[model samples]
Structures are given as structure tokens and as C-alpha cells.
Target: MGNRILIVDDAAFMRMMIKDILTKNGYEVVAEAADGQQAVELFKEHAPDLVTMDITMPEMDGITALKEIKTIKSDAKVIMCSAMGQQAMVIDAIQAGAKDFIVKPFQADRVLEAISKAIG
Candidate 1:
């Protein structure tokens, strides 16, 4: 089966950007979430092969939601997304069990690379 990805971002544009990247590269987009809370809910509902999560969001930030998702399934592979200079949050996300991270204004190749690294 193709790898399933759940995308999370507060901005609809950002979510679309990610979806465009993943779909063209043969990854199945299982769902999209506008915030981390929805991300966790989608994770439960879809049980996707991977997740691309945004760090800055309303209604539960990425790190907090990452922790919650980890509680549900420790083996869940999550790759975090952040804007430049969000180093502390990125570190916290890794500690919370994220498999990897991507910096924003994303590069399609880099995003795919991270997803491949996480899922494979």
C-alpha cells in the first residue's frame, strides 16, 4: 500500500502546499487538520502511516498534541513542521516522539525526504 499521510496546518494554504507535494510523489493524503487537536483526532480516525504536523497553531499547539498522540500510539511516526527560528519547539517535539521535522516555506523534495525517512 502507498504510505498514508495526515497533514496539519492552521493555514489552508499551507495544508494545500503539503498535499500537493505528497500526492504528486505517490503518498496518499489520508486527511488534513487545521490545528493540533484535529490532528490528534484525525490520527485516531485514520491511523495514517505518517503525519506532517505544524508547530504553531491555535486550539492546542503541535508539541502538546504530539504528546497526546504519543500517548495514544507510541509508535506513530510524526514529522513536525515549523517556521525558521522555532528551535526550542522543534526540540520539544522531537522529545515528544516526532520522527523528524521540516522547516516552513517547505521544499517539496525535503518534505518528501523527511516523509520517506519517517515512514520507511
Candidate 2:
């Protein structure tokens, strides 16, 4: 993927791991944020081609941030990252405006496939 991407996760290691996956596969990580509030701000500033947002974060959670970002850019492409068994939250995210979602303990192939489906 050639698009500029943003990764938002409260866990530093999670962010790092995803970044590594994207960068190693030729995606550009334009920004990374530790909280949902920061993710919103960064989205406004960068308007990256895509966003990978974690569901649980400080200050604001991913669903709220997803809603806020949708308010900012109606066509914003966001993919929620959630841990296993968060089905209700996942449904809420999809309802709110997330274009797609991926589960944690990230798989490199799954990430790429989701990004491709979202951006394509």
C-alpha cells in the first residue's frame, strides 16, 4: 500500500508492532497517537489516506473518536482495531462509520487485506 496511514493505540507496543507491519510492507505511517483525542487531532492535521484506530484508549475511546472524525470528514476511511470478543463494540463501530475492523494480536496478512479492502 502506498497510502499514508495513521495508527492510534494506547499501547505503545501495539502501535509499534502495527507500524512495523505497515512500514515493512511499504505503507507510510504518517502519524501515531496514544489516545483517541490525539487521534482526532492528528486526523485533522494529516488527513491521512487511512486510519487504524484502537477501540480502547485514554481521554476518548475509538468509537467516540470515530464519530468525531466522521463529523469532521464524512467520507473518512477508518478501520477499528479491537481485541477478541468485543462484538458489540465492533458492531457499534461499524454503525458509527468505521469502514472496516481488525482484531488484536495482529496478523500481517489480515492487516494488509483489510487496508486493501478499505482503501481500494
Candidate 3:
């Protein structure tokens, strides 16, 4: 099977967009979460190979969720997604253990590249 992945994004459109890119590239989307809290819960449930996490969310935010996921599985691979100009949050995500990050208005190649680098 292709590398399993979990996608987290508050915006349904964004989630769909990433899911589309991943599915088309032969990645298996194990599950999806609309908020960081859900992301954490799904992470525990699915244990996907990698996660594409949005930086901002309603309940927990991506950085906090990333830390929580790290505590659950220290070697968990996560990639933070951010809109342009969220550099501070992106840096925080990296420090919190994200494997890589992709900017918003998502580019297919960049998204695929980050996922490949993180899990393969």
C-alpha cells in the first residue's frame, strides 16, 4: 500500500484539495480531522505514516497538536501547512517536531515533495 496519511484542516475545501493531491499521487489517506483536537484523536486511532497539519485551527492549533502527537509517538512524522506569511508559526512547528511544511494555495509538487521527504 501507499504511505498512509492523515490530513487536518479546518477548511473543508483545503482538506479536499490536499486529499485530492495525495490520492492522485498514490498516497493513502487513512483519515482526516477538522481541528487539532480531532487531529490528535485521529492520530491515536489511525497511526498514519504521516500527517499534513494546518497551522491554525479552532480547538488546539497545529503546533499544540504536533507536540501532543510527538508525546504519543516521538518519531511521528508531521508536516505543518500554513498560509503565506505565517513564518513564525512554521518555525514553531519545526521546533515542535514537524518533518517539513508546505505553503498554502497548495502546489501539487511541493506537497508531494514534503510528504515524500517526510515518510520515504
Candidate 4:
């Protein structure tokens, strides 16, 4: 929870909720993005210790951005966020190098657990 984190989600509310969870838990939210394209750009600029990425997004998707970020920093620690039941997408994300994943309607404990596992 001490690591710097970048949050990527198309919904402003989702981003805000995540930021709230992370900040309250003593994590630094270095940057936030509304889409995968922006997420990739911000990743380069911030070089955050971790990234929380949303699967379905505009301009680009989390998987694509994850791949792009991996190209930039092969060891980038990215934790994907997805809605429930997107099994194929979750598998794809894992295969593409996501450190972990969290399902939406984000539970504070679950979020922290994923972050802990990813950053540790």
C-alpha cells in the first residue's frame, strides 16, 4: 500500500472511488487516466510503482494498454480491474502480464489485497 499507483478507468466515479480507497489506505495516487491511451501515456510520465487498469475502456482497452506498458517497462506492475464474469478477458489480462486483478463494485479489502499481492 505504500507504493505509488496509477489508476485507469473510463468512469470518473470509478477513478474517484479507487483514489479514495488507495489514499485512505496510505498509498500514493500519482496519476489517473480515463482511457487506455491516456493510461499508457501517464504510465510513461509517472512511472508509478503500480497500475490499476480497467478492462473495458474507450480509445483503447486495458489489455492493450497493459501490453503497451509492458513494452515500455517489462517489469511494470499492473493490476487489472474488470467487471464480474469477464472470464476470457481476465485470462487475457493475466496472460498479458497483469500482476493481479480486482472485480468491480470494488471492495476495499479486496482492492487492498490485490494491491498488496501485486506490489509485494
lDDT score, candidate 2? 0.95
lDDT of 4 at 37: 98
Clashes of each: 0, 0, 0, 0
Q: Candidate 1's C-alpha lDDT?
A: 0.92
lDDT (CA) per prediction: 0.92, 0.95, 0.95, 0.96
lDDT tens per residue, model 3, 52-110 = 99999999999999999999999999999999999999999999999999999999999
Candidate 2 structure quality by residue, lDDT tens digits, 21-92: 999989999999999999999999999989999998889999999999999999889999999999999999
Candidate 2's error at 106, in angstroms?
0.2
Instruction: Report each candidate's C-alpha RMSD, comma-separated, in the order given.
Output: 0.8, 1.1, 0.9, 1.1
- Candidate 3, residue 25: the lDDT equals 86
Pitting candidate 2 against candidate 3, the one with the higher lDDT is: 3
Over 64-89, each residue of candidate 1 has an lDDT whose tens digit, in order, gives 88898899898989999999999999
For each candidate, give its TM-score against the true structure. 0.97, 0.97, 0.98, 0.97
Position 98, candidate 3: lDDT = 96
Regions of candidate 3 where Cα sits further than 4 Å from its true position: none
Candidates ranked by lDDT? 4, 3, 2, 1
Off by over 4 Å in 1: none
lDDT of 1 at 65: 87
